[model samples]
Target chain A: MDILHALIVLANFIIVPAIAYGSQLALGALGITLVVGVLRFSNFAHGETMAFGTMIVILMTWLFTAIGLSIYPLPTALLALPFGIIGCIAIVLLTDKFVYKFYRKAKSTPVVLVMASLGVTFIMNGLIRFIIGPGDQRFADGARFIIKARDFKTMTGFKEGLAIKVTQSITLVTAIIVVAALFWFLNKTRTGKSMRAYSDNEDLALLSGINPERVVMITWIIVAILATVAGTLYGLDKTFKPFTYFQLLLPMFAAAVVGGLGNPVGAIVGGFIIAFSEISFTYAYKKVFTYLLPADWAPTSLVQLLSTDYKFAVSFSILVLVLLFRPTGLFKGQST
Target chain B: MTGGYGTGADILHDCTVAVNKGEIAVIVGPNGAGKSTAMKAIFGMLTMRSGQVSIDGEDITNLSPQDRVAKGMAFVPQNQNIFTSLSVEENLEMGAFLREDDISETMHQVFDLFPILKERRKQAAGELSGGQRQQVAVGRALMTQPKVLMLDEPTAGVSPIVMDELFDRIIDVAKTGISILMVEQNARQALEIADKGYVLVQGENRFTDTGSNLLSDPEVRKSFLGG
Candidate 1:
């Protein structure tokens, strides 16, 4: 009974939250990796793209709720997701056409494109802040918990209980579907193969009659879809704040770099690594360890590796360490 | 034709080269002889300031290299010719990217011509041996089933035995009624099998004749054939 209680406590505190957070990071990292692989530049604007998409989803969710529409167990934001995706796609394509097209035509270097994207980052940052007013927004409206702690305790006849948020379950399921669909598209479809070919060798792809503009356009569309879904899921899980989304750029970048910048599989794995690392380190082990250990041997201190406030520091440290030791990342993806 | 790279001087001075239907035309010259430039000019990669490149008298001088592929021309460059990261089958599939028609038959033909490629179809093209990668490059070009196939230094870094083997495959391709235009560093062996040969010197045609005629010419033999 004691061991089971300890396990349940661990699950409630660390496992569930990390899995949910990891899925969000995985989607974000995939978007970054795809852009890096296909477009050959690290887009600094990605965080803002997510923010803008989430902002649109929040606005649409508000409008829907105001009109008395409800999905009950599912967030109404799910209904507004397509609109978010459309808005994100429009902005990304317009940015590509008005901005990226010039650099590509001039055959500018990747560094130049990187700098251009930094410029794009500022523009999008301001645009999102202006539209959303730099405040936290409430969009999540659904049955809150899939498995309530109170019900679990009553049913199990145990001192410890486990809870699972509906949003958490939704994030995991949605990420699996998106990732599966993405892999299928990349491996089995014509356009997907062409994109991979283009990513491998641009000149050869052109020689093979693969259109560059079409590939670029398609990449942005996919990136937008990924960013919007990830941002919305994250917003549903936590508080929706533009600045918080912007700050997520560091962890998302760390995840991409750690996974291998241009490798899709690496991104997903990297996401979970970052999330588990952050959660496990920061979580206080006072209760779970108390359950497992004899009362005399129990730790008086919180037994946390780092304070929860220092969570972002963990990502930064991992990023620096990986860069120093293995710049190509675990999957041997493109460096930088 | 006369042109060079971007904003550069003309590398080929009014150069003209052609291959007949179902014949192999080999271009051979010393280093920096602009042998590849002439081939690129014919393929519309360079801006031909004064001459026209035509296939069956349909002037395609203004056509981009991609449009030329659509017009039944496939070019295999000397280096980085194959998509290294893709599987051999994917490389061939990518070759037929512009085709709306089914490509299973064309892929089958490619596999038939290079039986080894069929075995390694699932393997990454980069993992193949040097000779096999060249075969993949040729096989990829052949996927288009073009009327004209241009190869630039097809046997560049491969062994002598592989060179001979590639030459045999080139002959097989030509026998299928597709014209072959190739730039070669192996002048003696290339001219030996050539139906027609162009010995270019300083980007101009120094000798243009039947393969045996050039091989037998005293000046051509002394100057080029290392006699």
Candidate 2:
């Protein structure tokens, strides 16, 4: 009975939520890393960009539902993903054209670009709040679970049985597919190599005949895709709220920095590490530990190190520690 | 390709030096001698402060660096010469980025010029040693198929053996009828291959003569060559 209860809590609280949250952080961090590595700026507006993307997806989902289109078991928002990505891409490209391009041409310092990105972030924040009315919207429906908790218990004939939500499964599978595609694009494509070249050395890249404007355009487009996918997957797993999405910036930046700011692989690893730590530390471990301890040794109190309210502090402390010991990040990211 | 923007500051001070087709023109000077500045001024990296730069009898003083490349002027900067993260072939491809036509043939020509690069085509340029990286840099510049290929201190910081090998490649390149304009610190060896030579000091032409004339001249021998 004790072991079954422990397994139930573990499945429900630790494993499932950790993966969903980690995938979200990975996607967000990937966007941040790409911009820092290639475009050479710490884009404070990235969180707002994610919010705007989800806002677009929500609007599209609403339109599709209004028109009487039914996606059935799968969420309707999935069908509208392409439109959301396109819209997000256009917004990013326009931002680059109007704001970033001038700084690029003037050869402004990267810190200045960071400030500009903050300004854009504020504008994007206000814009999203205005359009979405700053409220949580439950836009997902249909096929809610791959394995319902009751079905799992009846099939296994055990007190604890694995229950896989449809959204949870989708988040893992979608993140895997998207990350694989991104890696392939970066390592195998011609334009991708050109971006790496530009990131490594700007003057030489220019001298080599690489079109700077074209590379910049493609970077924004790729970032848009990653941001939209990350944003949508996150909204699907949890409730969709504008402010909640904006607050994700802290954890996303934490993941990016902990992994080494400009390293893609590091960001993914860091995301999972951060998610696991946040969950494991805050989780009430009495149920799981009860199985290992002798009858009288088991304490009455829950063995949680901290409450869930302090989750943000966990990410922040980890970021500061990584910065203090290894400012370049775990992957030895280029400081430039 | 001329316009009415008259030469203003005379940074290059009405210098008339020439290298015929298929000849090496060596420019030599001490540190801060305006040697590189002069090359950059012609390449449009710096707005010449003054003086006309004509390429094959066309005034190109006002052209952008990319436009200069289109007009068959390839400049190899002294440092930061190649895209370090890019593979050797991709670096060459980037060199030919402006060309609408296919560049496979030009790439083959570069491989033939520097056979070492062929062996490391897939290797990143940054991983190569200084001398080998210089070859990649030169190969990238050659992808443009220019009428004139200019190099700034091609043998700088290289071993004596590598310097000799690089000089041989420079001569081989000249044999293909592509004019060479190189600035060098190794004055004596550089003058050995020079058909024409210019000695610059304090941003002015101090000596203009045939390579042999400057090499044997007492004034040139005393100050530059440490004879």
Candidate 3:
């Protein structure tokens, strides 16, 4: 292999996918961070919430597809997304009213809220599994690749080529749109200011006449939108399964903590870092790095830092390293 | 007994100081005095075991801090008084969260009162100095257009130079016809501008008189004033 071939392979296989994956993780992490910071609890059920929202979109897509209404060139799920978001918001609001609201009224500690979220998580997990049958579902179709690898090679006349997937483009674009909307809502609006104030100091926020319950409701709604977008994008990129969705908790949390949980921009940055590290470490560098080393020294068995199967371990290790060195994460989140 | 209470840490034991609609009433005490506790009790931040707190003669002894706020009472705590992460403008807006009116006019008035804050309107409240932070806290309380503004040790950590300036602002706020009830660590200075002054010690009233009378009192001067 030559330097040109290696570089192309690295860019095509590692860089592009990492950015899309990071964007997905960032959106999910931001939702988790907000819940923890403002609501003062580590919401264990967030992964399941993402799953639930995506499941709704998948179900809606199936229904729409059956009715002969395809979006064409884009996944029909894209059209079903708004309805999915609404469903997610309703579910979250209802959960807050019945479950979390009681704990809040009693002034329960954050740990208790964490436990409550765990219970909610289990319930949502069970509900999704029962309804969606806990199986991998391929709901995305119609123009799966923006540029096929064969097409890329033909176009460029290079030994290596660049390929972009339709799902990957959707992931990047959707993440950008969602993040921009979120920041705008948080920084430039009255209710958004109230939410930040409430997050900063709940007692003072109350004294300032902010309705805590209302802020919580709004927070849940925003979280629902982010979760739906994240989940759908992830499913579109990969395959959707209830079990896999539930298992995403570790990476999502790692992303949030690495980015400095509760800091929005930090979560985004953290997501990219985690995604890139996972990909770069697991990527079989024999194809990419064989070009750089001497022929004898390069005699290797897939020079990879870790197996792809251990992706979760990578996230956990990074999370532990971050916590040990910088307990507040990359950003100085709420010490209060 | 203090503020009419016979036992316990009754900071305002048997004490009754009224603002009378538009007067500045200052409460002065030693370091261990219950001045702040009394204010907290009045504002419903502390539970009153047995005392009546009223506003315009309506009983509000059991109201929460939020309820008290709704009933036209505003309190500025001595510490952590404002949302530090929020911008100066946001902090002021929070003060008027319950008001449905267009508070841009009130915000303008607040800016005029504290011109420095106006220059740093977009800056976070946490970045401000002690005196400026105190101004934000006070300005937030004023947004409610309350009948009475209760302040807890407004000059506690402020520099002496800034303390005098803050006092001047307080006096100016008093002229706006809002009743002022302040707990002061700087007893002499606080009493000087006060329409009525109450001296408390060990959770009980030590002296009650006009500001000049209390300032000149031989006993008050010996204990709280370091005379």
Candidate 4:
């Protein structure tokens, strides 16, 4: 019974949040990997892309609320997601045309493209902040809990209660559906195969009659959808603050690099690895240990490896270690 | 043909080579002889300073490489030709990308030509041996049902045995009534199978004749063929 209680406590604090956060990170990392693989640059503006999408979704959600629109038990933001995606697509396409395309035409190096993306990052950051006023926005309007703690305790007849949030469940289910759909599209469709071919060998893809412009357009559209979905889900789970999304660039890139940059499967596995590490390390595990150890033998300390405030440090350390030891990352993706 | 990379001086000067339908044309020369350059010029890879490339009497000099593919032209480059990350079947599928009709018949045909490829159809091209990778490259180009197949050093970096096998396969492909245009480093062997051969010297056509004629010529043998 003590063991069961310990497991429940672990689930309540660590497992659930890690899965949700991992899903968000996976989606974010996918966007980064796709751009890096196809467009051949690390897009510093991706976080801004997410923040801008979330800002659009937030505005649309408020409008929907003003018009007395509600999904009842579900968040109204879900309905506005498509609009946010479209807005994000437009902005990304515009950036490609005005900024990245010129550099691509000039055949600039990847470093130059990275610098150009940083410039885009500043512009998008300013735009998002100017429009949204850079404050925390909690727009989640839904049944907040799929499984309440009181109900779980009552049903299980246990001292430890397991609570699952509605958003957390939605995040897991949505992530599964989205990830499955993405893999299916990439593996099965003609355009998807061409995209893979383009990524594999750009010159060969052209010689095979693939239109580079079309491939680029499709990639940006997919990235927009991914970024919007991920950003909105993260917002629903936590809070929508522009700065928070901007800061997310760290863990997101870490996830991409650790999973092997430019490899989609690696990005996903890397996401969960980073998320679980961050959560498990920061979580005070004295309770779980107390359940397993005799009271006299148990330590008085919190048994937390690190505080939540230093969460990004964990990501940074892992990123550095991975870069130093295995530069190709876990999946041995393209070195360039 | 006369062209060079991006506003540079012409590498090829009045270099002309052609292959009739159902025939094999081979280009042979020493290193830096502009053999590959002439092939690229015909494939629309580089902008020609002054030249006319025609396929079945239709001018194709102005066409882009993609447009050339639409016009029933397929080229297999010497290096990095196949989609390395994709499976052999997927690589072949990408070959027929522009086609609107069913391609299973074409795919089966490719598999039949390269039986080993069929056995390892699910394997990634990058994992294959050098000779097998060349087969995938050729099979991918054939997926378009091309009228003219152009190859740039198809047997490069392979063992002599593999080279002979690749030449045998090239003969089989030519037997299917598609005209083949190829540049080869194995000058004598290439000429043996070629219906027509051109020996390029310093980007200029020094010898253009029937394959047997070039092979039997004393001057050609002493200079280019290394007698």
Off by over 4 Å in 1: A1-3
Q: Where's the lowest-lDDT run of ten residues in candidate 2 chain A?
A: A327-336
| Model 4, position A225: C-alpha lDDT score | 91
**What stretches of model 2 exceed 4 Å from their correct place?**
A1-12, A156-158, B1-11, B16-18
Pairwise DockQ winner, candidates 2 and 4: 4
What ordering of candidates by TM-score runs from best to worst?
4, 1, 3, 2
**Interface DockQ of each model:** 0.83, 0.56, 0.76, 0.90
A1-336 per-residue lDDT for model 3 (tens digits): 478878889989899999999999999999999998788888889899999999999999999988999878999989999999999999999999999999998999999999999999989988998999888999997788999888989998887888999999999999998999998998888899899989988888888789988899899999999999999999999989988877888899998999887888888998998999989889888877677776677846888889999988999999999988887888777432
Ranked by TM-score, the better of candidates 1 and 2 is 1
Per-residue lDDT over A1-336 for candidate 1, one digit per residue giving the tens place of the 0 to 100 score: 788988999999999999999999999999999999999999888998999899999999999999998899899999999999999999999999999999989988889998999899889989988888888787889899988999999998989889999999999999999999999998899999999999988888888899998999999999999999999999999979988988899999999999999999999999999999999989999998898999888999999999999999999999999999999999969987
What does candidate 2's lDDT look like per residue over A50-139, in tens digits? Answer: 888888999999999999887889899889889889989989999999999999999999999999999998889899889898888888
Model 4 chain B — which ten-residue stretch has the worst lDDT? B1-10
Of the candidates numbered 1 and 2, which has the greater DockQ value?
Answer: 1
For candidate 1, the docking band is: high
lDDT of 4 by residue, A61-155 (tens): 99999999999688999999999999999999999999999999999999999999999999999999899888899999979998999999999
Query: Clashing pairs in model 1?
Result: none
How should the candidates be ordered by DockQ, best one leading? Answer: 4, 1, 3, 2
Listed per prediction, chain B TM-scores read 0.98, 0.93, 0.92, 0.99
**Best lDDT goes to which candidate?**
4
